[model samples]
Target: MPSPEPKLIAGNANRQLAQAIGRRMSMHRGMQIGLVDARVERFNDQEIFVEVYENVRGEDMFIVQSTSNPANDNLMELLIIADALRRSSAARITAVIPYFGYARQDRRTKARTPISSKLVANMMVSAGIERVLTMDLHAAQIQGFFDIPVDNLYASPVFALDILHNFKGAMDEVAIVSPDVGGVARARELAQRISAPLSIVDKRREKAGEVSEMTVIGEVTGKKVIIVDDICDTAGTLCKAAEVLMDAGATEVHAYITHGVLSGPACDRITKSKLKSLVITDSIQPTAEVKACENIRIVPIAPMLTQAILNIWNGTSVSSLFDTATLEPIYEPLYPGLAFE
Candidate 1:
């Protein structure tokens, strides 16, 4: 017998991105790809509830959600949805998270602090998710927190294509920069793709949400610097790094970040910063303030995500979607019993 049709479900967190992904799937497959009818809402006392009206028994289910702002609420919604699907007897469930929340707290920094990312992973596994598909995780090692198969996609392919089109004929004068030492790998990949030089921002962080000092490691003199990172939460690091690069004689600075969790005064800071433009993917839905920012531009990742979903459905290797040399998929299971190999 043939396999059941793939079903795409969206939560309240990022309906726009989910719809875009559906549209891309439809365009590519020449068929209408509709989201399963579901209701995810809260009661008067802020109690979350979820209901899946359509039949999904024995179907390959993909739940599209991004645990962004109001992270706790959205996270609960996803878990509830997964539980509902599992109870409904879905063949397989994949949590398609474009932006995984609590990813920054992947490790225990303070002696008594919690590794919240691991807890979140455990919660998902307990909630009945069999597999995970996410993009641009804050920390790559967070995959180990899950016992199930995890496919961490990269946005470098999308960013590289955009850079080529936007900076055509001027690639020689461009330089890819990592905002801090931690992001050197991400920056270097983009640099290699564009055949440009690479630079690093060596910084000292005195406390959370603040950078005490930053030093540029390489030459940005007379170059159009492009800073690449995974997330832009408060915009503090990007803005400060841009200033430092400019002070060191860089002609212009732009940032290509995957997740734009532009909370607090991020938009304001970007407006007042020395950066020419902030390019972010539509992994997390942009707020009105972010959409209205004159210096910010959004590139849709719906097409890339749609392709990944299709690969998963077809039982093909999703890693082949990206350049293997630059963006390798983490297939080795970090936990013993959950190995995909």
Candidate 2:
């Protein structure tokens, strides 16, 4: 007998990404994977209201929501959705969060502070989510906070393919740069994939949201540099790092980040900075300001996400989808003519 179909539901957080995932799954599976109707609205006084229209009784459910800007509202929306599905008798609920906000607060640095990431994890479990599917968490340790199974996806494969395609014959002259010491591992992986050298930027953080100084630890002279990072909030670190790299005689500096949380003044800073371009995944929906920035390019990770959902539904391992050794070069754009603006 065939397996039962899984229900795909999305909130207001990232409808475009959710729809793209649904469409890709439908095409790949040779059957429609339409998103289940779910209304996520607000009361006049700012309370959240969620109503899952279709019956989810005993069905496997995936709720796609990225708690991006207005993080609290979106987070609450996801929690409510999970609770609703649990109450409706869904067999299992998977929270597909592309851009997990508050992930940077995974650890406490000061005298006394909360680990907000752990709190978020607990809330998901309490709301009755059985699993979590997310990408490029700010801190990997955040997974340990969750009791339920959490599948953390990577964008290295996607970025590697794009770098190979775009950089082509210039691969030898390309260097992968980690914006800070913390991202060295991620940068090394990409560098290994593309047969490029790795470099690190030693930075001192005087306070939150600020990088006081940066020192390059590798030779970037006359090389095309690609700064690799997980997130770019204000574009401060990236912008400063790009300036330092260029000042060190690098030909050009580009960035490939997983989540572009391009908050206050990010687009403007990127616009005026020396970075050649900033390529980011569609984890967080770009705002109007981000779309207007010519230096910014948004890549679609929907195909990858769709395959993950399909694998989970089929009781298969998710890691196989991104196994670099066996993965082929992605020749075609996942979403053709996807307008950034």
Candidate 3:
């Protein structure tokens, strides 16, 4: 007996990446993928409408959507799509979120703040997402929020491979700096892989969209500092930390963040900052602003993700799919810089 073909479907969050994944799976004939627009629009009242164009009856479906900017809309799109698929009798629906939003709001900082990350996870499960496949979440513990089998793939291998390629000998003098104490585990893992020293950016994020006070916790003097974090939203934290690293005598500063959710003024800050190069993964499609920065480079995870997807479909262990590869980051044309007064 043969197995039924699994379906690959993508929402409007990131079609380019989805297409690349589909292209990789094209080798397997008889496998069909459905791409629905799944974009909701607002009328007068801030109401949302969702439509699923394709039929998913009794089919194994993967909904590819990255909850990036306009995070709420993209998240609703994914949930509604999952609901539609479930109601239509899809055998199993998997929400493949490359960039999960509301992740930073995982814990309650104050007495009454909501754990929105857990809310998002619960919503997906309620919407009929039987499983989840996502990349480096802002908080690793967010995996526990999911009741379904969640595969949290590491972008470290991808980032580590690229760092070794371009940075080359700099790895010997490298100081992997975690932008905050919370990210020490991830930073230390990368540092170990590259045989580099680990450092910490002991800082306090006083409030959202605000500058943080950064203190270099390790010896970064005269070393090439490589900052690692899961996401870079405003670039405020990273840019400020870069300055602190330089002041601490770091010869050069570079960053390898998994998701470049580079929102307002982030590109400008990166372009004018002290960092030599900023490496980001294509987990979320870089916004126009981010793409324009001269120092920003994108490393494709299509191949990495393709392998993971295939492994999932084949009932194989997804752990080894994150094996280190020898690939360099891809440098695309920079966006035109607008000078500030």
Candidate 4:
């Protein structure tokens, strides 16, 4: 006999991404357990309310929520949904947080600063979340903040495949660059995968969210440089790095980011910057303004997330999906109704 399908719930945050993951689950794993009938609403004073209309008693439950913009509201909505699931007698509750907010606050640099990421993790466990699934966390050590099982997935394989496909024959002319010294490891992985040279934008920060100066570390003259990073909020660092790379003699500069937190003036900066293109994942739903950016593109990770969900259900190794040989290069775009061009 076949096993029972795991039920999925979508919070208000990134509902489209959750629905896409559900469709891919049915298409790839043949599991029809799509988004559970849940409605999240607000009251006159802006208090949140959630109702689950499905019969999910004793079922393995998963809630797909990305604590993106308006982080507090989305985070609270997730906790409330989890509480509802526990009250409904869900056997297991896994939070599929495609983009885990507060992850960048894993540690404190100044005195009396709260480690918000740890606090968030504790709240989730307190609210009855048994497991966590997130992609390309800003800091990997944030996984240690949670007491339950945590799966931190990477978007490297898809990115590597896309790079290999686009730069088919001229791999030598391509260079992978980290927008900052912190991201060199991530950039090096892609550089090694494609056998391209690695570079770093060595930058000095005078304060939080401000860079004083930047200098290129490696040879990037006359090469197509691709900047890789986990987050792109405000696009200040990204745009500056592009200018520095161009000044250092890069033929062109492109960016491959995991979470596009294009909060304020981000799209405008990218639109006016020297970047040839900016490729980001659908972890955070694109706004109308983001879609209007000419050089922005979105890649869907529903298939990969679906496989990870299935593996988690079966108690298998989700890391095995990273095997490059079994995967094919994404020559064309995956998600529809986004700026793919």
Please give the lDDT score for candidate 3.
Answer: 0.80
Full-model lDDT, candidate 1: 0.88
What TM-score does structure 3 among the candidates reach?
Answer: 0.88
Cα RMSDs of all predictions?
A: 6.9, 3.6, 6.2, 3.6
Task: Tell me the tens digit of each residue's lDDT in model 4 across 1-341.
Answer: 22388778999889888888888778766657579988899999999999999888888888999999999999999999999999988899999999999998999978999999999999999999999999999999999999899999888877877677666677789999998888988888877777788989999989877899999999999999999999999999999999999999999999999999999999999999999999999999889999899999887887778778988988999887665443442223432222211
Please give the ranking of all candidate structures by lDDT, highest first, separated by commas. Answer: 2, 1, 4, 3
Residue 33's C-alpha lDDT in candidate 3? 42
Candidate 1 local lDDT, 194-283, one digit each (tens): 788999999997987678999999999999999999999899888999999999999999999999999999999999999999999989
lDDT of 4: 0.87
- The positional error of residue 115 in candidate 4, measured at the CA in angstroms, is 0.5
Write the residue-wise lDDT of candidate 3 on 17-86 in tens digits. Answer: 9887786666544455435445545658866666666666777788888998789878988888888889
What would the TM-score be for candidate 4 when compared with the true structure? 0.94
Please report how far candidate 2 places residue 246 from its true position, in Å: 0.6
Candidate 2: pairs in clash: none
Off by over 4 Å in 2: 1-3, 325-341
TM-score of each: 0.93, 0.95, 0.88, 0.94
